[model samples]
Target: MTIDPEASPPRPPGRPRSREADEAILGAALDLLIERGMGATSIEQIARRAGVTRATVYRRFPNLTDLLVRAIEWEYQNTQPEALSWPDVPAMIRDWAGQLSVPRSRRLIRRLYGTVDDLPELLRAYDTAHGSHRGRAVRSTLEQARTTGQLPPHTDPETLQLILSGAALQHLAAYPDTTEPKDIEAYFLAVLRQVGFPAASPSPSRRSTQR
Candidate 1:
């Protein structure tokens, strides 16, 4: 028997839904994931936390993995890095590190890393999206440094790009519970100094503080 198209059940009506609902749902999902971690979160819990029906959540996201991947993308878009200054690399690194160290963001990231083996496809997508932006930013910053003479004329931007990216990730993983922002700032500044950036100016109380 042929199915009648018009006889199919009608889509439930609402005022034309807001595109913002998608953003809201993603944001809520990320928040819940951060609060509860991966193992504890569920589709039903996310729907409840997002204040939408489970069907609505599924309509937007095919599964928990899809929801998580989209939520990570949404968070990345919301926190796009600002323009960088060549002379301010230390401060920029510190700021980026601080953003990553935030409790919720850190928790989500930790959970994502933990599940890489089980959800390689989702992890690949997450890595591609995040790595693209990070790589672009690293290249831009290094290029600007070369143009402005902050870095040596012969310094390889590509090499510096890898170095800076690896250093940032390593530091974040090593000091997940960073308490002093200044300490983080100092660590990056030390890297720059080793790479030939001039040492930062001494604080006015440097002599007293040292004693």
Candidate 2:
């Protein structure tokens, strides 16, 4: 799953927020989170890695949890393409599976899921901060897919989204150590079959040629 970079609204009418500092802090936090698990990554470490004062981080985010959540979401804004299009969906799916199979993404995702143990409340707060960015995009994509007959007329995007996301988490968790590409692709096909994906399912090579 991805977080929205624009999760935080404009700093109220009071003081100006430093955009440069915001970017630096979030970048540092994300790097640290990937390298170190949530339990080990600290606010002070983030501050030090970011080359900013602890006060700077606190000013941008209330605490370590907020800092971590925002950093995850911020990557969505900065790293993602301007648009998530249908033409890119197949490739995006492949890339997502690849990411899930990798070390960094696996660690970050597991860490987020594990937050329930000690920071369930903080995770809930992050859900509120998530806003409508990714949800809206997913909805729009499903609607377009439906319109194009890429999904069955009777398909429910919301339910499908939840199932796919949940299954993806399960997939990552099941292969906590390593996930083979073949395994991920098999999982991908299973998910598509369940969703009744209307397109002709192609082998990776065939898909590349088709694209």
Candidate 3:
């Protein structure tokens, strides 16, 4: 017996729902933001670049801002450097600095800062998503340092954490166009020194090791 194509249970309304499409849309949104900045990115552009219909895009994201926030969050969650497990404070700070200096991460951060004034709400969303987690990590690292006596008696982890985070953000904003590896390293080291970590030295013995 010949079977008719229509006889196949009508496959859900249109192209089968695809998780891949959702990821593609999010990825495209992130790439566009980094390349063109938030003001120039639109839902239509995301849909087109993601190879999905506008309706499909809407099915995943209600609006451009929502998509943008999700895209940033997704990228942050997936791209965050693996948590460092250094035995002491200075090493942890150095590891954090190295992670932040990664080229793609630096670009994403610079783009985010560039759009902050125009998209305050989106920036707020981004902060709310990443800030809490980051704060906790900073607190933990600082507390560990305090317990080990790596930090001075007067040092406050919360205040220092805010300073470090703000400084790093500002540094990225200040040098969005310059991708010099040494510049990035120097910026972080400057912040570290400002916060009381000694300037990094070529020879380990030249620096007062903070363990």
Best by lDDT: 3
Provide the global lDDT of candidate 1 against the true structure: 0.69
Summarize candidate 2's per-residue lDDT along 69-158 as a digit string, tens digits. Answer: 777667554444334433534554675576677777677667766777887754554454442444556666776777777777887878
Stretches > 4 Å off in candidate 2: 1-25, 48-62, 79-81, 88-92, 120-132, 176-183, 199-211
Error of 2 at 51 (Å): 5.4
Better of 1 and 2 by lDDT: 2
Q: Arrange candidates, best TM-score first.
A: 3, 1, 2
Per-candidate TM-score against the hidden true structure:
0.70, 0.62, 0.73
Model 3 CA lDDT for position 199: 22
- Encode model 1's per-residue lDDT on 1-211: one tens digit a residue: 9653423453567646557668778878888777776778888898777777677777777899889888877766644455333345555676666656566655666667767787665566666667566677767777677666677676777887777767766765787564466766777777776776642445779967987
What are the runs in model 3 whose C-alpha is more than 4 Å off? 1-16, 79-86, 176-186, 198-211
C-alpha RMSD in Å of predicted model 2 compared with the true structure: 10.4
Query: Which parts of model 1 have CA positions greater than 4 angstroms off?
Result: 1-15, 18-21, 79-88, 121-130, 176-178, 199-211
Candidate 3 lDDT over residue span 1-211, tens digit each: 8544533444466766677988999999988888888878999898889877677788768899889988877876753534534566666666666666676778887777777787776677667667566677778888777666566656788998888878777776665544555666666667656655642333665444654
**Backbone clashes in model 2:** 0
